[model samples]
Target chain A: MEHGTTEPGTAGPENQAVPDRPTPTPAPGTPAPGAPSSGAPAPVAPATGAAEEEHRPSPREQERERFRRSRRRRDTWIAALSTLAFLGLLAAAAVASPGWDRVHGLFLDAGEFRAALPEILQGFWLNVRMFLVAEALILVLGLAVALVRVTRAPGLQPLRLAATVYVDVFRGVPTLLLVFLVGFGLPALRLQGTPSQPWVLGVIALVLSYTAYVAEVLRAGLESVHPAQRNAARALGLSGSQTLRHVVLPQAVRNVLPPLLNDFIALQKDTALVAVLGPLEALRVAQIKADYDFNYTPYLGAALLFIAVTVPLTRVADRLQRRAAQRTRAEAAR
Target chain B: MNEPLLRIRGLHKRYGSRTVLRSVDLDVAEHEVVCLIGGSGSGKSTLLRCVDLLDVVDDGTVHLGGTELTDPRLDADVARRRIGVVFQAYNLFPHLSVLDNITLAPRIVHGVPRRQAEETARGLLARLGLADKERDHPDRLSGGQQQRAAIARALATEPELLLLDEITSALDPELVGEVLDVVADLKQRGMTILMATHEMGFARQVADRVCFLEDGVIREEGTAEQVLTDPRHPSTRRFLSRVLDRR
Candidate 1:
């Protein structure tokens, strides 16, 4: 996880392409010298090595290559057309259902979708702002907790214990339950300094719940670095904190980027949970529209909005994991 | 010698019930090179780690320039500022470029200005024949080049004494000589060094004194010619013969 986690297309895209071994693409039906094939095929001397031998591929070989290319092209067309056809038929079946007209009128009405779009989109902006603030706070606070937990300093013992307790207690509490507590419990006390805004309480709850999880992820990342690395840094005269900032944390954050991004995705979706605390977020807007017109198209619109943000985040998370694996797998060659 | 730069007396280290170093005592004077020659599990590395204050000593005292590095009351980090170490495997920070690796300690710990640190790092890199590798990450370099860069990073602080723990042990045969040549070059510049090595040939050529360690204790100590050529201990003889036989 230490720098092995590749946040792709962010840095110079080319270097990340093959951070380790630039896998030499397989030769056409022959073992190529310098390819260093991981599969370890027989080390066949290059056909071009001997001037006396005909450099041209044999007729049978040419025939096989042409067949392979044609088959691959056929497979692509078949897969694409079949996929579209299957999806089209599934949709057609849905439209052809016995209660199709009522279902469409309630759930797929373009007029309702169009009318709800403006309010839902506006409410989604609240959701976006809530998560953005929560995510920023979670990143900083989570790292602070992780660093505290990872340290063995005598002076930090109290802090380390508190951080551990905080993680255990808050992480165990359901995020929704925590949101309810912050939104209702604080106001019930009527503390002078307590936040009055529902959205603020929602953010605070999200921060607390996610910080515990992110801290654990970060701690795992910090621990994943080899002990020798710590020794190397300490031997160089860096203090514990300096070693962490300069040596350990960078690698740790890099290692846990995929999981961290995954958490952010969860946090983004959870932002809609704040609607329970009375914010005019997407979920609440959808609920209001559905109640008013007895139509659910606005709910579908809300779902689509969440999917719009999450699908890309999920894709980024997947790419990060795959790239990290590739980087480690290519480590030996590097 | 006016005063030995690094002095160790009765150093002992143990991991749980297994003792790794047993009452080890050694010293390196200014501008001298001392080689600890032994087989695996002989505690050459443990002894080096203890001197660098990397390991918590079970029992011992290590003084670097009169500061008791092993003293619990002392600041080990400050003591480490005067001591440089290069590991068996090049442990250059992978996230850092070669220049950044070299400059990290100088700038962060020593409070050297970033520009000054970079200047010093480039000078060290250029001297180590890696002038053009400033922008390259550690993994981008070959084993030999990476080891050399690690050495440059160790020397960036201009440490008073350098500790090398089998720096060439991980290198391929073809790559070992380049790193050894760099060590030799450092010696010529009057840098004090204490190193563990399996390279008897290189040790013989450069070590002012050789200490043979066996079973967590220093079994023999003398000039390289006396200890290596005219062995006083049977284990040392056997070890050297086995090493030479392989070559």
Candidate 2:
């Protein structure tokens, strides 16, 4: 059936239109965007018939609006209180500590502490390189593992089982332990050589360890797509692969992005875990600089570095979660 | 008058040790709408699934047009593409907008171009009264809109036959009317529709023929008025009484 539309004035009293014969009248009674009500007299039959059918807001829609208003109220309170409390904490901590004076000097003067913004920035670039490379590897490997685990092919069972076991072992074991094993244990096995730089070794270790956990996260997201979605695609005559490509994977990945972003923020913190491998990630730079200065300024600097990296990532995660939540609630109300 | 568009014979299915559908026989003429009504677990849905080839029947033959679909020499994949099945659950792909859900099958399976399919999908969505929801995902749609989208999704394939497994049962009471209105529209359009439904009133209103299944067997079959209002078999009367008592 083609979508039929009627001219705007066709349904007016003087131009009363025939109803039920596929007259395109903008679906009777639908509020057209930005329409100025001309007080046009209502049509006689067809328009009135459709008006009776389609104009009312469904009960589900009514319930959804109620739900949204209640959630808005609750979220407003949470937002206001958290902001005030955080500001209060910052003020109290600043008042209790005059140690910030020395910390300020360390940042401004390169001569006194042997620590300058340029040197720290060089380390920051290295960290950025490491994260980008690791994330690329993580996405590809994790997606492959996720697909392997979710596929229905019989011969792939062993591969799927192995992926599951691998995910379980890696996720259960401490990331710190896994990174150590990658950096140090491979040399004992005589299978590979450790990279020359501690930073290089740290990147490899972090990537290897995190990839295992990320793969499982990806699998969970893939599985979150409802079975009905797959069935609907199949009913449409799509091949199994086509169904996955067009219907299943797109939604699964969208549903999982919030969690994936959460994982990314955790990944930033996990980069600090590379400190054990001796890469001059933010934490390692702070510790090395603190040793030279005989002061805790480097340690405080590391905390600030993490806050800088994490705050923006968390905001993105928050936005994703809010959208995901609103969608979920709307769907539930339906 | 016309040769049947669909024919089912000696259909039998089992799950583990439990027999869900016994040997059953049925047929549907081209452009005819047949409604299957029975109590829960009566195998009406299972029969629809088998006909659509969504489930591999343990043993049976489903003939589409003139082709024997379940024969060992026949390809199940090709058989499936010829039949479109709408589930009771209205499984609209949650990620795709309503329009995408309708367009995807035609584009991917039938090899229709994206632009043509989009136009067709937009047409169907609008006809189903979901024009405003074209950009909204399934999760954002009401039960009726979602079911209508499911219907549009099935029709997008241009399948000769449509298998509806209680598509309106999952809807809220107020929403059932809209979904049934779509079904009525399809019926009036001369689409071949075989529906398994719990909506006895809608079944009476739309079905050309109504079949009653009991204990996985077709207990009775007759004209809609004959079967729904004046059933002759004692078992059919008992079933009708039970259905009416609930209302």
Candidate 3:
């Protein structure tokens, strides 16, 4: 750490603090470490306009730089140690069987993997449709149930309890059991014509199961709305329903968007559960291709398809979350 | 002169085992401003809520402008429309723009046309010194601005009685003056305000009558000058002393 010096773009310690600094190049003809003037410590302040490019450091900033150096060294050592361990494991696995060579051969053929893409993506589109429909149903049903639960009306208590029990039972049961129950048990009960198709049953199952979880999300969202909002609306002579529709639901919905998007992503992946009911979703397509071709390339193709959809959606959600956080921070600063 | 704007008789409320309001009685003359002041948990808010039918009294009669508000047989909704309330927290809807927040109730509750409601909302916003903020959400406004917008929202219906419950309590020290100033402006314009406030200075300056509540009952009631400057009740003196010492 050293005393202050003028630097045009640099902010003082009290203002505009940031974590990183790019290294500035030293001037030409600077003395090396063991040169004639190196015996004494360097003087910080000089006569007016002497190069004016020497870096100034405060005591705290100097300590921080030293700490940063040590931490970087520690991280570098950890990375090197982990890399060595991974190489050793790879060597061991390779020696155990027809190993690293096979793995390399499996991954290096990009052409074979790319050929199966059209078939995999066809199934993946159907999976997307199933996810969207299920998520829409879940969101609407969840919001209605959450609203009923928060209502002050005594008559809605039974309805609210029924919704709660429904959410608990559906969420508590495994998604596979739900798909099976809808696909197999519904036909046995003679509830529908030929139990519908497996894809339909899968969608129904996902909607039912996910709605329970989404309802809790909506409940939390509704709870996040301040009570004064409701009170203010009521003071304006609005009815209970009007107050909820006008004042509570809109804000609650915005607060719940990120989590709701996350649920949609989860539902997208979980659509593979349709395989249990016997439709070809992305995973099922991968399975069929693997079974027919007797190769792992088709499965990899399907994995990439799933990643393409999910990764972009996650990025969008992340951007929205950051914007929301920034808005909150700005409001706090105000 | 036919009936008082608000009248409460034999009002009672209890929370679990502890009684909060015990047979409270009060009346507000036509277009009169009444201030209810008390220590915490003294039930001023509860009594005020009961008058608006926001809370139902155990055994009481609450009449607003000659219509019985707490009567089980009457249209409580209609009675409620005649009274507007402002809470301590401003309570503006965060999702809606300032214009929408002010107009939402009129359009939804009273079946006012959107165009007419918007016009009325703009007028109220202008009156509240928020004409330029109609497009902004509540989060964009300062605490004082939000409270003022909330007051405009409550007044959009032209309610016969305005109930304000600690309207400035949630404001920042710098913001409190702006909110209290609005309240003072309202008082001067002869708005029939029933406020439960901790602002002793504002109460002394504006309130027509001050009622001191303790243990769910009015311990003392008098003109603002007499009640604030020359309190006869020991509890009132104790309360004033504590509040004054802090200042």
Give the true-structure RMSD of model 3: 8.4
Each model's DockQ?
A: 0.54, 0.29, 0.28
Residue-level lDDT for B170 in candidate 2:
80
Indicate the residue-level lDDT of A33 in model 1: 35
Model 1 stretches astray by more than 4 angstroms: A1-68, A332-334
**What's the residue-level lDDT of B221 in candidate 2?**
96
Give the winner by DockQ.
1
**Docking quality class, candidate 3:** acceptable
Candidates sorted by TM-score, best first: 1, 3, 2
lDDT of 2 by residue, B196-225 (tens): 998889889999999999888998999999
Error (Å) of candidate 2 at residue B245 is 4.3
- Candidate 2 on A74-188: residue-level lDDT in tens? 7789999999999999978875688766655655444533454445656666666778778888888888888998888999999989988877777778888877887676655
Q: Model 2, residue A243: what's the lDDT?
A: 79
| Residue pairs that clash (backbone atoms under 3 angstroms), model 3 | A2-A57
DockQ, candidate no. 2: 0.29
Best by TM-score: 1
Residues A1-334, candidate 3, lDDT per residue (tens digit)?
1112222222221122333333322324332334324445543444344444544764444544565666668778999999999999987977677665676556435776777778788889899899888887887888888887777788888898898789889889999889888888766776546647789888888988898888888899899887767776777788877777877888787887888788888888889888877787888887877777666777788878888889999998898787667655654453
Q: Which residue segments of model 2 deviate by more than 4 Å? A: A1-115, A185-198, A278-280, B1-3, B72-75, B245-247
